[model samples]
Target: MHYKEAKHILSASNGMNLYRGCTHGCIYCDSRSTCYQFDHPFEDVEVKVNAPELLEDALCRKRNRCMIGTGSMCDPYLPIEKTELLTRRCLKMINRYDFGVSLLTKSDLVLRDLDLLQSINARSKAVVCTTLTTLGEELSRIVEPNVATTRRRAEMLKTVHEAGVHTGVWLCPILPFLNDTEENLRGLLDYCFDAGVEMIMNFGMGVTLRDGDRQYFYRKLDEHFPGMKERYIRAFGDSYQCASPNSAELMKIFQAECRAHGVRYEPDDCFAWLSEYEDKQVAAQISLF
Candidate 1:
C-alpha cells in the first residue's frame, strides 16, 4: 500500500474512491480495464491520504446536500481499510454533516461501521450495495479470491437490513461458460430475497472483457479452467462485451424471481433510490414545527 495526496475527493456526481487500487482481487474487476489507466499494479493499493480532509472540505462547500458515494472504483473495505480507517473517517464526516451515503463493497468488513451507517440512515439515507457474482463458495473463492464469499456477503446484507439500512446487490460480470448458469443465478437471487435486499442491479448474464482486465481474466481462466482461454478467444475474438449464451433465458428467470419476491430489478429505479437523499429527521422537524 502507498499514499497519495489527491487534489479533489468527490466526482461531479458526488462519488469518491478513497483508494485507487483494490486488493480484494475480483478476476473480472472492470476497474482494472486498461481504459482506467492504472500507473501501478492493481493490488498495490494507492491510498488517498487526504481523502477524509478533502471530502470534509467538499461536503462543507456544497450548497445542497446529496448522497456521498464510494467503492465504485475500488472496494472501500479492502484489507488496508482495517488500519487506515480512511473510509471510516470519511463516513464520520458525512454523518456529522448530515449527508447521505451510497457505499458499494464485496467485503463483510463493512459490518464494522454498522453504527455509523445506522446513524446516517436515521438522519438521511445510507444504502449499502454489495456484489453477488457467484453463489457457490468454491467458485466464489476461485473468482473473487481475496474478498468475502457470496454467502458471507448475503449475511452482511441481512445484517445491514436489520440495522434499518437498505441494501442493493450488483449481480454482474457473470462469466460465460463458467458461472453463467440458471442454477448460479437462482442460488444468488435466493440469497438476495432471503436477505431482504431492496433492489438488485444486473446488466445481464454476461461479463465485459477489455485490454487490462481481459488479459488478467484470461490468465486466471488458463490457471483454473484449462482450455477455457482458447475457448474464449475462439468465441469472443477481441470483443468487449462477452454476453453469455444463456443471457436471455437467465434474465427471464431473474426478472420473474425478482417480481415474485417483490425485489426491485429495474436498474434505473435502483440507481434513483441510491442517489436520492431523504432527510427523515428534517421531515420530522418540519412536522413538529
Candidate 2:
C-alpha cells in the first residue's frame, strides 16, 4: 500500500473511494476493466491519505446534509484499513456532520465500526451493503478468495440489522457456467431474507467482462476450472454482457422471494433509498406524545 494526497474526497453525488485497487481478489471485479486505467498493479492499493480531512471539509461546506457513500471503486475495509483506519475516520466525520452514510463491501471487517454506524443511525441513516453471489463455501473461496465467505457476510448483515442499522445486499456478477444455477440463486436469497435485509440489489443474473477484467477472469478460470476458459470463449466470443442461460429462471425466483419478503429489489428504487437521508432523532422527538 502507498499513500497519495487526494485533492478531494466526495464526488458530485457524495460518493468517495478512500482507496484505489483492491486485495480481495474477486476474479470478476468490474473495477479491473481497462476503462478505469490503473497505473499500478491491481494488488498495489493506493491509499488516499487525506480522505478524512477532505471529507470533513466537504461536509462542513455543504449547505444541506446528504448521505456520504463509499466503496464504489474500492472496498473501504480492505486489509490495509485494519491499521490505516481511513474509513473509520471518514465515518467519524460523517457522524460529526450529522450526515447519513451508505457503504458497500464484501469484508466482515466492517463489524469493527459498528459503534460508529449505530451512532450515525441514531441521528441519521447508516446502511451497510454487501455482495452475496453464492452460498457454497468452496465456490466462494475460488471466486472471492481473499474476502469474507458468503456465510460470514450473512452473519455480519444480521449483526448490523440487530444493531438497528439498515442492511442491504448486492446479488450480482453471477458468473456463467459457474454459480449460475437456480439453486445458487435461491440459497443466496434465503441468506438475505434470513438476515432481514432492507433491499437486495441485482442488475441481472450475469457478469460483465471487459478487456482488463475479462483476461484476468479467464486466466483464473483456466487455473481452477480446467476447460472453462475454452467454454466461455466459445459461448461469449468477446461479448461484454455474458448473461447466464439460467437468467430467466433465476429472475423469476428472485422476484417472487423479494416480493414475498417485502424487500426492495429494483435497482433504481434501492439507489434512491440509499441516497435519501433521514433524521431519526427528529422522528424520535416527534413520537414523544
Candidate 3:
C-alpha cells in the first residue's frame, strides 16, 4: 500500500474511489484493464490520503445533497482499511453532512460502518451493493480469492438489510465455462432472494475481457482450471464480450426469479435507484423553523 495526495475526490456523477487499486484479487476484475493505466501492480493499492478531506469539502460545496458512491473501481473496505480507516472517515463525512451513500464491495468489513450508514439513511438513504459471482465457497476462493465468500457476502447483505439500510446485489461477470450453470444461477439467486435485496444488477451471464484483465484472468485459469484459458482463447479470440453459451437460459431464469420476487432486475432502473437521493430529514428540518 502507498499513500498519495489526490487533487480531487468526487467525480462529476458524485462517485469517488478512496483507493486506486484493490487487494481482493478477483481473477476477472475489469479494473485491471490496461485502459485504466496503472503504473504499479494491481495489488499495490494507492490510497488517496486526502479522500475524506476532499469529500467533506465537496459535500459542503454541493448545492443539493446527492448519493456519494464508492467501490465501483476499487473496494473501499480493502484489508488496509481495517487500520487506515480512510473509508470510515469518508462514511463519517457523508453521515455528518446528512448525504446519502451508495457503496459496492465484496468485503463484509462494510458492516463496520453500519452505524454511519444507518445514520445517513435516517436523514437520506444509504445503498449497499455487494457482488455474488458463484455459489460455493471453493469456487469463490478460486475466483475472488482474497474477498469474502459468497455465503458470507449473502450474510452481509441480510445483516445490512436488517439494519434498515437498502441493499443490492451485482450478480455478474459470470465466467462462461466455470460458473455459468443453472445450478449456480439458481443457488446465487436464492441467496439474493433470501437476503431481501432491492435489486440484482446482472448485465448478462457473461464476462468481458480486455488486454490487461484478459491476460491476468487467463493466467489464473491456467493455474486453477487447467486448459480453460485455451478454451477461452479458442472460443473468444480477442473478443471483448465473452458471452456464455448458457447466457440465454440463465438470463431467462434470472428474469423469472426477479419477477417472482418483485426485485428490480432492469439495469437502468437499478442505476436510477442508486443515483436517486431521498431526503427523509427535510420535513423534520423544516419543522424546526
For candidate 3, write residues 28-123 as lDDT tens digits.
Answer: 999999999999988899989998999999999999999989989999899999999999999999999889999999999999999999999999
lDDT to native, each model: 0.92, 0.94, 0.94
Total backbone clashes of candidate 3, pairs 3 or more residues apart or in separate chains: 0
How many clashes does the backbone of model 2 have?
A: 0
Q: Tell me the RMSD of model 1 versus the true structure.
A: 1.0
Q: Which pairs clash in the backbone of model 1?
A: none
Clashing pairs in model 3? none
Candidate 1, residues 1-289, lDDT tens digits: the string is: 8989999999999999999998777889889898998999888899999999999999989999999999888899999999999999999999999999999999999999999999999999999989999978998999999988888999999999998998999999889999999899999999999999999999878998889899899889999999999999998899998999889999999999999988998989888888999988879999998
Error of 1 at 267 (Å): 1.2
Cα TM-score per model: 0.98, 0.98, 0.97
Output the TM-score of candidate 2.
0.98
Model 1: CA > 4 A from native:
none
Q: Over the stretch 39-149, how does candidate 2's per-residue lDDT look in tens digits?
A: 999899999999899998899999998998998889999999999999999999999989999999999999999999999998999999999987899999999999998
Error of 3 at 179 (Å): 0.3
